[model samples]
Target: MPLLSYSRSYSPTAADVGHVIRVECKATKRVGGGVLTKTVDTGLVLPFPPMPPRRQMLANVNEERLTPRLRQIGVFRVLTYNILAEIYATRQMYPYCPIWALSWSFRRELLKRELQSYNADIICLQEVQGDHYKSFFAPMMEEWGYEGWYLKKSRESMGLEGKVDGCALFYKRNRFILKERYPVDFNELANDFLKQVQTEYDLDYQGPSMAAREMFLSTLNKMRQRLQRDNVAQITVLEVVPANNEMVARKSQSGPLICVANVHIFSNPKFPDVKMWQTNMLAKQLERVTLNRNLPTILCGDFNSEPSSAVYEFMTRNHVPLDHPDIQHPPPQLANIYASLDLEHNIGFASAYASVFGAEPEYTNYTGAISRIGCDYRRSLTEALLLVIRSLDRCGGLRMVHTGDADSVRRAEGTPT
Candidate 1:
């Protein structure tokens, strides 16, 4: 026989929670007219320990008082995470962590458990390896009635072909219908921008300005090469499904649509201008997608920028001046581009954590060397939603929202704390 497989169920009781069970598999086949047998140990398996109680969601006094009214509409949860990639989780990068703890096999089981515990309607993940998404995450989410989209980084291969990491977005299949999806490759955006610039230069400078044009072209090419990092983002539009016929009748026939954008911006600190450019590009893309209709939008991901940074300022404030200090880095030429770049967006976004807790969390990520919160969620879904904020889970960040009622404008009217 080529191969055959079967499964035998062995239900365990509460008594078997911590007990270990050793298992092995044996398979036989014919090779060269002879019989070949191979046995492999699958290793010890133990029922997982009881999970700790979930952390309570923290809401401002005003929101807490309005909880009764909020619950009557609808409730859904969203989570954003930057699961450390296996390639980057090396002994050198994380010396304090045990080698076994960093292995994908061990981490995947724990990640699966942690992810499921949240029971979120939508999940945005960063640093997810291409192979891992295919082999583990996509299938696992499907088993739980979630469909997902994945986009690998678009730069040159890093050592292995399938090891490169990217961003992934998943939503509950029954809760939301996929309306549209946009995979944003920042590298491609850079290329197109440079091409446009080159064409303009060629058209403008035909005679005596040839010398200046040559110099500008040389600098532009250098900038183009520098901008080709493998960063990417995903913009998805989902139409919410009504809970019942009663709600459907109350709400519009089409149901409310949400434009959710997930991004993993470039992490290198040396190029603050690049970070600014990427953030601005995402905002422009959002403006384009939601131009015709004011679809409630939710932007969440690992931005790799701090709350006090220019990127965050532009996102929440909807405007940032050309002279913002954070956009000015050592490379004067590259910095000039961002300094003059338009940083304007009309989509009003309020940070969930800041709105609920009076300020951003102290830390959303932890490691031996550094503990930082380089991610957040911005929402303009106040027309039909109420955000219930939860404390940051070290593994990921979570935000819950209540939807369904369409006439709720009181919550969105006031400024976020």
Candidate 2:
């Protein structure tokens, strides 16, 4: 592939604030004896402040509640998204999607449609607000054959008078029945660790001076507060049921259980130690569940830590030393889907737009003056499959199972048997 770059600038008046402008580009390449030309059209729109409308029905009033059993046979799709909470959709974070476009009223339907398109059996979401969970996600998902569970950060921990954002998990009710739920609270764990420290070593007696003791106490208190306010994880075990009783009986001999852990780790880039601690804690929690039950585990979330961080290394590597004040036990070996599938090669660029355009994207996290848009700046589904195919490719019959996307099907077809 050849590299290409193009740039243009234009000035707009106040009247064009919310209007979308179309930009078109054409690329031509000579192949064999003919020329192949491709034209791409993109739209740039200014962010309009979101305006809240009247409260709408939580569920579809017209549609009857249908409870149909969906059979589970083989592997199912899973999706993880960090739907930016409405409360945090300020003008600073999203300069483009401001007051109008960023409102829950406008983004809710778009998020729903995008999520529906994925058709995933299990969905994990982060940063979902409390009211939105009751008024929107729970009811909407219930209507769509899913049972939803949400856990919000406590008011005291969050230092907020009202509700705050938290993680939410939704699963197809018919395909899988919830067996067990273990909610991990790092804050409580930190408190327990502090108590252990206090008991094991006398802080006052060992201290060289009163100032030193005060400093130690202050540091410990701060750490405790931070941990309490940190994001939490929910681990849910679901029993996968086959179509009929006969198939279920056969499968039940081994007791098929799927453990899905949904989490949202702390986002502060400055405090990498906190992220590492949280990741290790989560790993240990998962290990306890899986070790006891021998369940197939699927961990998903907006980890907030990048691929290169110690947190990522701890999760993916077979054995790594966790040197943290709060870490008591070694975390069990867990496989990172990306590394296990060898999809790291596909991530040559930082942003999704960069991958598509073969250059650095305008912005990865937010929309700015350029208004560049593509798939959410994350690795594409095609890239994710490349990772999945590493092990599945060995299975002859199941090599190309459910290759939905055109690019993925092409890639599968091109791969040697």
Candidate 3:
């Protein structure tokens, strides 16, 4: 009799880039003293998908004029994407996708290549899973000279080991320094708002009308429940890295700071009210976070609202009256409350895609069953800055747009410069 052992391991390299990877195993038993083996190759093969072409920035007439002026201050590219979480990438949800293609192990390789190819200054991603963030993104991004932050949805874990999806933001370490960060837990904010209402009601009421107080409290409770969805946003203030010439020329070493906000709002079309409320809450949060100083702000998110919806209108117009039809959905009591919610803000955010391209793309997100306009960037002009935004479809190649806020051209939409 002879002792036998087998080694089983393989790691792919750049040489295997365009080829399929397969594995085979063999096993057998010999009656006398030697080992015999029959080999079988499994059906699994790793195929490298084609890389998308590099994105090209498209500058409109207004942007073209301000390019030289903007370059003096600084310029950076921003990318926002919703890389579908593994938990949600199910056979039932995407029946058209092959099982192997839907697996996280396989898709992550493709994502790694896609993300690196962009070479953006800042990247905002939604649907980043907790386990993957720790095991994959954080370490991998760090190696690529990026520092990242993650905020899980504010809810008890519903998936395996209490794992859930979240939003992840990464910035080039050499390009920006983190000044401050605020993790917004919408559910917590809802509870705090309810508490404020209770305190105000107690302070204002003089009469001992128990019945009236009971009714008011009940309404407040209902509103609290309605607003307590586990959505969140990450707000960070980052100071730009100054150029070598500017560093030596300036007496103050402090560089200009920009406030960047990344969010993923509620996605239920049936409850447009929830989406609207979340958007409104985010606006208020931004207002408070950037008080005292008007930092140039870049808001990125998967709003889950279309251009035609009330959410979009409120974001661009800076106000949406209480009676807007989108805020008038069912549950008579909630409807009435939403109608009087007082949705207004002074952020003065303009859609980056709309401003540069004259309109948003027909679809920012597309799938076999549903095509949607969700992820977008909203730029707030508080300082002299230039933004060159580039986007790529999940399947299509790339689209880009260049924009700026110069003294000559304050906005892409022809505001009084």
**Which candidate should be chosen as best, given TM-score against the real structure?**
3
Clashes of 2: 7
Ranking by lDDT: 3, 1, 2
In model 1, the Cα lDDT at residue 311 comes to 78
Model 2 per-residue lDDT at 144: 96
Worst 10 residues of 2 by lDDT: 381-390
Candidate 2 lDDT, 51-165, residue by residue in tens: 3232121111111222122123355667777788877778886554336566688689778877887778888888888888888999999999999689876544234333588
Residue pairs with backbone overlap in model 3: none
lDDT of 2 at 214: 72
lDDT string for model 1 (313-397, tens) is 8877888777777677636766655544678888777677667555655444334443321333222211111122211211123
Alpha-carbon shift of residue 281 in model 2 (angstroms): 0.9
Please, what is the TM-score per model?
0.75, 0.60, 0.77
**lDDT, candidates in the order shown:** 0.67, 0.55, 0.69
Q: Which 10 residues in a row give candidate 3 its minimum summed lDDT?
A: 386-395
